[model samples]
Target: MSKILDKLKVVELTTFVAAPTTGRMLADWGADVVKVEPLEGDFFRGYGKGLNVPADTGENPLFDMYNSGKKSLALNLKTEEGMAVLHDLLKDADVFITNNRTKALKKMGIDYDSLKQKHPRLIYATITGFGDKGPLADAPGFDTVAFWGSSGALVDLSIETGNSYPLNTPAAVGDVASGTNLFGAIMAALYARELNGKGDKVTVSLYGSAVWSMSFMNVIAQEKYGYKYPKKRYEVNPTAAPYRTKDNEWIMLTILDHDRYFPSLCEIIGRPELSRDPKFIDKIALLNMDNRKELMQILEDAFNKKDAHEWHLLLTQKDIVHDILKHFKDISTSEQAMANNYMSEFAFPNGQKAMLAKPSLQSDNLGEIENFRGPYLGEQSISVLDRLSYSKAKIEELLSKGIIKQ
Candidate 1:
């Protein structure tokens, strides 16, 4: 059977991660995604440092990771001719996905209201920090500010605490979340349009998307606990926090199988007292303690007798739930990840053997796609213009006028 989005045509007009992410997902599923970039190209092209080689032209691993399986056409939207090219591209586009604001869009007549009039069946989707019409809408919707910090996630994760914690992973939380949710919205709208024979606008905000990802905590605080989480960091579960192993390595322990693992853990650690003491035994009572410091210290001391590897092995032998702190390299080389087909190796045009993490979904027939060395600035402009029925003469004229990047 054809892939899901075989008939879908996506005009991706936004830059950076979140917006491009939506288009990338669609393109992965076999949609005809045409990335409309600025003359300077997407800034993400410079996001990566030293390439596989010292002076490789395709140095942007970030760009390649996000924009694979899509064609790019560079155009200067500030130019009237470039804006004209956009409207032409929109003629039969099934969906328009963007993170750029309405004012910028209105100048190019790419606004939802404007496009909907021209092609009422076109699905218009947007991603922003706030709603398009809101006061904070104009704020740059970055993953750090909008997704993590503003969404109450940073505070919940306690990265906001003055007391030091490890730095966050270098991933775009908001962008990926926004992309995921926006993809869902676009697909749902497309499905709905089949029956209604009409398209609709789908909107997602960085702040709102971040909050939705935290629905579990929201429910627990509002309904179950009937109390607001403290503005300051509140330890949700004191016993489950990070602990140190005997060899001076950090291990996060959550003895939630307290009824089960508690006894085994005690036996392994030579701390039968903690297992036997009723005052410090049960979770609720332990939580209610006036002096948890003594108990915590005891547990920490007991844990420090062995290295992380020894503890991991000993705990697993007893069916305890625990894990080691895995770095990016660890996960990359992990046997489990390899077994699950999560990573694939490919040879780039430069003849470098690189490993790429697979997309969230998998298919037996889906093309194995690791060699897409992201486009040069407007690399496919002439080819893309040719598809739009522009003659070679016209394309050269446009390129020579500095109206589009090549």
Candidate 2:
């Protein structure tokens, strides 16, 4: 079946995760996304090397995961000629995506104001470290600083102990989340354009996205509802925390409705007698701070008797809300991830098959996806320029002038 965005054309002038992720999602939905890069290619092309993937590796799966199924056009945007080429490409494009710093964008004459006036029908989307008008608007930030640190997520995630440091999350968690937010904004803007015959600018910041993700805690604190961040052992719902099993693996439970599930949970752990005890008999009794501490120790002692896999099976059978805390290695082969289309097998240029993360959406009518590896730098420059009606001699002249690459 035809993909959703088959008629759309996107010019992606983005680097790293946040904005590229939006472009990747659009490409997956059949948009003709042309990734514009500098002569050196996106900086992320070298990211996997820093992660210890060998330099000799034929393909960077990390880059491919976010950039596959897109064409590339390398240009020297620092030059006036190169900027002119970009304007030509954007003339008929449906969307322009970028995450460049605001000052640099204005200086380069490609900020939303500049482009929206020239291309009134173009959807101009931007991602930034902070909002455009903030004091830190021009500050450079990555997932670690903007999303986690500045968003106050680090404070909430930190342990209560004085010496404890803020917990570090998996890489690009915030960037990926922010990308999804931008994707939604772009789709909404597109719908609005459909109604009004005009496109609008869309902007999302990593800091704003991170703060939104942790809004629950912030709302509770702001409302003065007497909610306090809890230590692991003193969590409001002792049942909803991680416990180590006999095999040293951790299993987490999330039975929010303690009143409904406490009896079965007690029976599952071979502690049926505790279900009727005075301190643990009801949700109200267990909700008391002292009783919660007592129940936590009891559950810990019982959980330690069984391996995490055993609890996984037992909890599943009993319909308890729980999961084995998965290690990153487990993700590639996870049955659930595969079934949900969160990951899939793809072949690399070296003819080796590997699992890669997939776009979140899955539809039966997406049709047969093309087999594509990430583009080499400016790999499609000649073809893209040809589409713009450049003569072969002119294309060659531009290549010689260091204005374009193919």
Candidate 3:
């Protein structure tokens, strides 16, 4: 089957997770994505080393996860020649995605307004730490600082976890979410372009994404009957929380239909009598903080009586909506992940195989996701320049002048 984005072309000037994530999704749909990086390479190409990843191979799996299958064009963007080369490349491209700050983008003359004037039909998507028009517009925003720290997600999450010390997020949650949003915006802009014969300036921010993710709680906290996030013991829906098992494994339940699921949950935990108890007779009664705390204690004690695996079987038999809190490695080995093509076996240059996630979307016409390795620095520099109609001698001269790298 032909790929959905086979006719599309993208120019990706991005680093780390967010913008690259958008490019990866485009590539997954078969867009010819050219990743423009500095001569030294994207900073993320060396980020894996900081995590103590073994240096035995040229592979940077972390980088590859979001960049695989994209062509690399390493050039010195600070140089006028390099900027001209980028302009040439963009003249015929369908999309341009970047995560550089407003000042950097303006300095490079690649801001949305500038690009839109130059190429009215080109989709220009920009990702920032904060929205582009704020006092902190040019501030450096990594996902950690902008998304978690500045967005109050760290504080809000710590409130639930009962940790006073700000907690670290799993990893790149904000960046990835922001990128996914950008992808949707770009798609929408593409659809609009089809009708209007002109593209759009799409922008998304890590702070904005983080806020959107937790807007419900924030909304409630500002309302008339405002309330802060409750502690686990005070959670109104006691069944919809995590409980520790005999094996010390945590199992999370999402029994959202409190009235219908509460009785069954109590029965499955061997505390059936609690279901008929007066204080816990209905969802309204359960909303009482004191009553909820007592019920949470009861559930916690009952959960501690069985191992997580044993509870999993019993819960499955009861048709309960619950899951064992698994580590990352456990998720990598999940049967559901494999069955749904959520993960694919990625073979690295070092002859090692690791299962990496396929792009998030799934479609019948989309073939099996390939595990193409990410390009080395400037891996396609010469070819890209050649395709842009640069002469061989000019390419050599540019390389010698440090304007481009291969």
Query: Which residue pairs collide, candidate 2?
Result: none
User: Candidate 1's C-alpha lDDT?
Assistant: 0.75
Tell me the TM-score of model 3. Answer: 0.95
User: Which of 1 and 3 is the better model by lDDT?
Assistant: 3
Q: How accurate is candidate 3 locally (lDDT)?
A: 0.86
TM-scores, each model vs. reference: 0.87, 0.95, 0.95
Lowest summed-lDDT stretch of 10 residues in model 1? 229-238
Put down candidate 3 lDDT per residue, 318-391, tens digits, no spaces: 78899999888887898998988888788789888788886667777887776677888899999998988899
Give per-residue CA lDDT, model 2, range 1-406, as digits (tens). Answer: 5689999999999999989999988898899999999998898988989888622237678888888789999999999999989999999799999999989999999998887888999999999998888689899989899888876667665657757777776689889999889999999999999999998999999999988998887787664686676355566567788889999999999887776788889999888888788988777786688988899999989999999988998999878998889889899999998887788888877777778887775667785444357777898999999999999998999999999988
Q: Write down the TM-score for model 2.
A: 0.95
Model 2 spans > 4 angstroms off = 54-57, 230-232, 367-371
User: Model 3, residue 317: displacement in angstroms?
Assistant: 2.0
Better of 1 and 3 by TM-score: 3
Q: Candidate 2 vs candidate 3: which has greater TM-score?
A: 3
The number of residue pairs in model 1 that clash at the backbone is 1
